[model samples]
Target: LQKACQSQENNRAGLGADKKEWIRTEDILERLEKVSDDRIYRVKDALRLGVPVNSVKKLTNIDPWYLMQIKELVKLENELMKFNIPEDIPEDFFRTLKVHGYSDAQIAWLMRVEEKDVTRQRKKLDIRRTYKMVDTCAAEFEAKTPYFYSTFDTENESIPSDRKKIVVLGSGPNRIGQGIEFDYCCVHGVKAAKEAGYEAIMINCNPETVSTDFDIADKLYFEPIYWEHIEEILELEKPEGVIVQLGGQTALKLAEKIVNAGYNIIGSSFDAMDLAEDRGRFSDLLKNENIPYPRYGVAEDVDEALRIANEVSYPVLVRPSYVLGGQRMRIVINDEELERHVLSIFKHMPDNRVLIDQFLERAKEAEVDAIFDGEELLIMGIMEHIEPAGIHSGDSSAVLPTYSLSEQAIETMKKYTAQLAKALNIKGLINIQFAIKDDHVYVIEANPRASRTTPFIAKAYQVPFLNIATHVMLGSKKIKDFEFEKKLEGYAIKVPVFSFNKFPNVDKQLGPEMKSTGEAIRFIDDLNDPFFRKLDSERSMYLSR
Candidate 1:
């Protein structure tokens, strides 16, 4: 049991728990080994945190005599430094040195010891570094399976068996502002469905993600989110609804494929998602709704892209039609860079259907993570980026209760966000990013699917957006039936973690592109603790680093 506990302790480290609970060794050794009084007296103080001898013997079934010898040796070796002794000192001399501090020459004169005895004792005290292999069984015991993870709540919901099965598509990997946080939405949807007695499925490829954990959904496909593969799942599951809105772009892009294949889209309909994205369509929405947006032009070829770029002016933003993790998005500062980027994006897409828009300079970036039951607009949390508009939000240090924006700007943000959610007919979570300059607010991007801030806000605000979305999809929830009067008063930071340094020679840049592998959530309320907050933000206590 001692060995078993130690094995589990080492394995638990992978879970990213800060200040892990540790064990002790002396008590266990003394009791189990039954050491002679002389040996015990010689080496007792050197042992670290561990179990008692009886407990160790009860757990490992090792003989007491051998354990005694090992324990005594460990004690003698470890305590050599404590006695102010040299590395060459023999164990017998430990008693002499403990009584008095001395150099090798003085000890040799009094105890008839060799000068080299001091050196030997110090060397024996040095222990080799030990590395433990992670025990897979620890995960098996602590983690949930695909089915049970969906029901985090102890309460149960009553639903008919005829209810349509719904599965939320998953955003595969970690990106700045994104990561396991996206799965918070995924888990929410699953739990909602399960509570309402509906089957919830999740389709994703990233194994390291939280949603992929065994019990997040009723059934996890562990499949890639591509048109080819998703179409097949639609055919088999024949789900009454497919939740494209909570899964991010991977799910959003698949929405059309499902519709074209004549399958039902669970949360936001294909048309609604299209209105939110499809640069041309979104532009039309801004015009129809009288919403403010940056000037934009869709280019079909390099010549067209260059022409549109010229019209939009230098330092314009260009984005490809269907990409993930901000695959080919950038601010081209000059014609040369523009030319190279355009060619590269065109080469990546080949067809060249990209949108170029004017870059809003020096604007504060804000985001609204909201929920809608396809009717009532539920504002979960408003997230503001510390970085300016040009930085990929996922890469930016985000804060709740946006500090710098004017009240009017925040109002405009909330209004537009609600409007966007309602217009898109979103039945789940929606994360919208905006660039606000002075009194003017411009639409940056709106994801009909679960935005990166889902978990951060959910945890920060103490609201259950994911569970609500699932209930709505299953027709268990009605808009306006429930109300919330919560406001994000305190601050929360969703800081991104990177392994680029681990990948030698990796280019480090934050733009309208995502480059992050994981994130940590922290609740902060102190202005005086900004430095501590910043340091706390460096490493997350809950993340699997």
Candidate 2:
């Protein structure tokens, strides 16, 4: 019996070891073709484990040249890891790493130091990046397009004009939470900046966006929205200010880094963004302002999560902090579900924490997109979601000129939004979500940057809200300076468009996480028009499919 038990234990241990080996092999192969959150680390791990390039190529089916390039990078990283930070580092070593596309964040991790230390060292060494122009004709003609790229070279092609310039950092990529809506805002922001007599410069890496179009701005930087890349551009162009609000959370996340490096952020301050995104700070702000919010608790472990779940009374809306598109957000109704979900999340994201809020069942959700300059507030339009509060606003069908909200409720929402904006000192655009439960309004979430509904609100009201918000950010116009049509002649319905047919394996259920890839808009003069309403519904369904 003892021998039998030992055999079983050995088999289990072998199975566990085999699974880990398979995962390591799979992860190394995955890093070759597509980028993962920890692709670099995985590559480094495979190299350290002495995985052969031929083996990686066979598994990943990637080209040998690319594999060799990655191997070289891994070698460099290994060599750099041996050096003591301030003592043994070479003078040109950092520049060499930067030339090979190594980000400061990665170097900081290797050196066991803060990213700010790397930035400070690079600045102290005067190892600056040069900007090269992306003339549309490839230098064949005097091209009017002012696109630029960065490199470690001697001469820079970018020529600063006499006109004041404002750099617009674009939303990096079209992901679930942030899609083309932000790109639309960036494009319009460039136009508005140009119209306001400032040279508009765009910085983005997404080729799929209109903001990357060569003609959209006076100068376009086809580069990643990394702190290192942005710092180079700021040094070269010396723009009057940088606008971070129009680009979604991608740009907003860099506000503090940019500001700490002594770059001027034109619109909403970094403190305002922190206040809105940080759960504890935001909770305190709401408490001080006497604003109503759902009961909530923050947890970093399963015990804390369970405690919070029990305190919040069973049904709780739980999500991780500092995530976009409500990633990994779930509705937990029992301790079992909470434990399972929390364990799964911790397994995947060990460093991240969770927030649990009392779920407001069957509440009506409304979104307000408003522009706020320091002194004045312009409520663009109130949108009422067709679905309940649990569904993400991006995935829900929303109607502008709110179909169900009462005048009193709308006024209350506006008042709350204005108060929050004022308290945050927001200068450009702000989107706030409110839940109406038991005839009381509760603030759900607030995004100080441009929301996904900016374009929808602009089309519904026939006002250039994006452009107006840009001007507001540039301090060229106040909210009251521009006139917006108070009442819409027709109601606009913004329906989410899904690509379920393209990805048959994905579940087709609406939840807090945004799943829709795009959206379609429809207009109706009257909601009571049955024939038109039916046609509109059919069109919306067809488009969504």
Candidate 3:
């Protein structure tokens, strides 16, 4: 059983608490070659319940050292539970907890208080973290690489430079909705920062992305996206400003907190981001601009959602506010489905409000990537989705230089795009999605930051959109100062790639929620290609394997 659990741990397969009994009874140790997170939690629980460390080690075949560490963690939790208020928290106590990898949220759970309270207490204690260099050459030679990490220990390795610097927070991880596209933007932003004679600093945790590469920027900090982690880096770097627009929802979500802490935001203001994300605020803006949008309502409860559904009529689209890649978004056709969906959403995200919009069936969906430099707005490229509305834009295939929309409609979209950008006072990249039904265009969504389509649009137009946006954000250039290629002679189709074959048990159906893992772009000189005929002929040959 121990060998089986070890194997499972190696495979990264999680086992449940129910597997404990099976481990005791079944000799199917060969079948149980992995351990799960729940199994480790069970061990912790057993240790907390006064089970001897040696006994746990005997049963699970885990190292005695690991068991002792778990025992210490449990003891710490028990000690933390004894504290009643902020006054009871000793100065060194919080520092010790942080050194043990106790996050503010975890400490909050133990202390029965809000996470913000923990943050406040930590700040009161003045327990700041120090930054350390990665030291790729073992400190043998002075390295120019900016790779760094944070630690509670004393010695600081991040020496402040004399050059003006712009800190770029990278998207923490490569999850769906926030992936390589944002990294692409970050890389370009770093390059632009260097070209503009400012030291570029990148902070991110994901090792899978180019943004985290040691040499990508002047300084790189591999750190979590938590408030405390960012605060520490900011204290050390003391940058001219931080750029949040290129980091996707991860960095965008931090704008409010960072701004509230009085840090300078270089690109779009937090108010602009809030206006774009908050459904109520965005709806008001659209109304003021006379921009058409689907009838929608925001609800904090199931009753409110149901009422909104009735007002919007059946088949309403629902999503949580401030989410990317259409996470947990769904379309419901009836009251029963709506209620069930709302309940499920609230189960995981109780604080989030539901946004209900009248589903526009058979609408032609389109996307526009534009750059706004406070005064002037430049539309980079307009992409029309091949699949009709309802499919998530990230998962839908799109064609550049829209093949479907009329010239007049395209012009109207550009006008609306500029109007929205100016109204928001945007200073960098902004992406907007629209739906056209019955010859009327309705705004579906607007992101006041770089969208996944920025890279694709940039490649299509043969212009570095992110680089230009970065310079614009830094007050180096305006929209009209640079010559841009607005039109391309050929068509480019963005085809989404899926990882469904790797997860056979998961459903392959695509809908409002994004499901594609990656995307590929294919450019053809002519509308009709013999290459497509060859692809059709070879489809069966590829599928058989």
Candidate 4:
């Protein structure tokens, strides 16, 4: 059961919670595995309910050592629940809780208060974290590339540098929607910052990524991307600014918190990010700009969603705000399906509103990755999706230099992209998706930071798009500073790679939700070749296992 739970945890790390398909077959083996995992938690519940460790082990075959550990943790949680704040608890006890890996959110959960209140209480109690360096050698030689981790200690080894520094938050872990792509951006972003003569610091918990390489940044903090962890690092490092845009959704979600903590977010402001992420606000912006967007409505509950579904007619696209890789996004054909999906979405995001858009069934989908420096915009690359509008862009095969769109359509897309970048007051990278139906283009969505396609576009254009965008965010470059190629000489296709065989009994159809774990690029000089013609005609290329 423990091994099964570990396997599920690993799978969850890879696929992420958001990328899971809501509708799928119920494989008994999978169900049994899940039951095993749930039983581990059920043991915790039993212990909390005053069950004996020996009884738990007898009933659940879990080792006594593990059961005792869970019992101790529950005991501590119950003890902590008696105190309202850190100030109310003993200093040594609070320190022990921190050392025991109790996050602000977890403490707040037990105390029945907001996480911020716990954080404030900790601040008032002077219960702050300290940093210690990861000594690779046995203290025989000083580690040249010093990487640090946080702990509740008095002695600190990571001394603050007086030199100007920029902190680049890294995408925490590799998941289906956001894997190595954002790490590619972070690597380049730190290099660009270093080249710009600023000491670059990177904060990330994932050791599998190149961005977490000891040599990648001048100083690396091996820490979670949680708000409390980030705040502690920022408090210690005192960086000139923090770059949140390049780290995908994980780091992007922390932008507001970083700003509220009085740290400068180097790229687009939080308001700009919010404007792009909030569906209602973005739809209003599109309307104000006279940019065509799919008829959409925001709903806070099931009745509102049903009303919007009826008004928009059948077959609507539903998604939550501020999500990446089409997380919790669905296409429903009728009111019944709408209610089911909306209810499930609400179950996950109880406080947030769901966005409903008129599903453009057969529209050609395209996206643009561009850079903006407050005043000017440069389109990095425009990719046309081979899988049409309904499929998630991450799972779709995207061809750069837009093989099918008319020149006028391309120009119009570029214009609309620039307009959005300007309206959002974007200072770095921006990605916008569009759908073309009946020869008219409509804005699908916009992201005010680097998208998964940024790296693909950079390679397609044979330019350092990430580096250029980083410099722009650092106030070191402008759109006119570098000349771009007037025309792309070749076509670059981004092909999504899936791992359907790894997960048994999983649905294998491409849809609005992203499923691909990785991507590969194919560059071609000619599209008229017989093989290329076959690929174009079929719109898919498959490889045998």
TM-score to native of every candidate shown? 0.65, 0.87, 0.87, 0.90
**lDDT (10s digit) by residue, model 2, range 1-545:** 11111122111111111112233666566675675433434544565567897876665565778667767766777788898673466767777877776666666766777777877787788777777776678677797667777777768788887888899999886777888989999999999999999889999988889999988888888877766678878887888889998888888878998899788898888899889998888988999999999999999999999998898796799888877787788887899989999888887667788999998887889999988988888888889887777877788888887877788888889999999999988989999999998678999989988888989888777788998999998888887787667546778888889899988988787787779999998777878867445643543231111
Q: In candidate 3, what are the lDDT values of residues 24-106, reduced to their tens digit?
A: 32333322234643467567666666678887777778899988987887787788878987558887887887777666656
Worst 10 residues of 2 by lDDT: 9-18
lDDT of 4 by residue, 244-351 (tens): 999998888889989998999998999999999988889899999999998999998999999998998878999987777788888888888888999999887676
> 3 or 4: which has the higher TM-score?
4
> What is the lDDT for 9 in model 3?
18
Q: What is the C-alpha RMSD of each candidate to the true structure, in Å?
A: 21.4, 8.4, 6.2, 5.0
lDDT of 1 by residue, 213-272 (tens): 765667666555655346545655678777776666656766776888787887667887
* Shift in Å, residue 390, candidate 3: 0.5
**Better structure of 2 and 4 per lDDT:** 4
User: Distance (Å) between predicted and true CA of 102, model 2?
Assistant: 1.0
Top candidate when judged by TM-score against the true structure: 4
Cα lDDT, model 4, residue 377: 82
Off by over 4 Å in 3: 1-68, 114-117, 138-144, 530-545
| Residue pairs clashing, model 4 | none
Report how far off residue 201 is in candidate 4 (Å): 0.9
Top candidate on lDDT is: 4
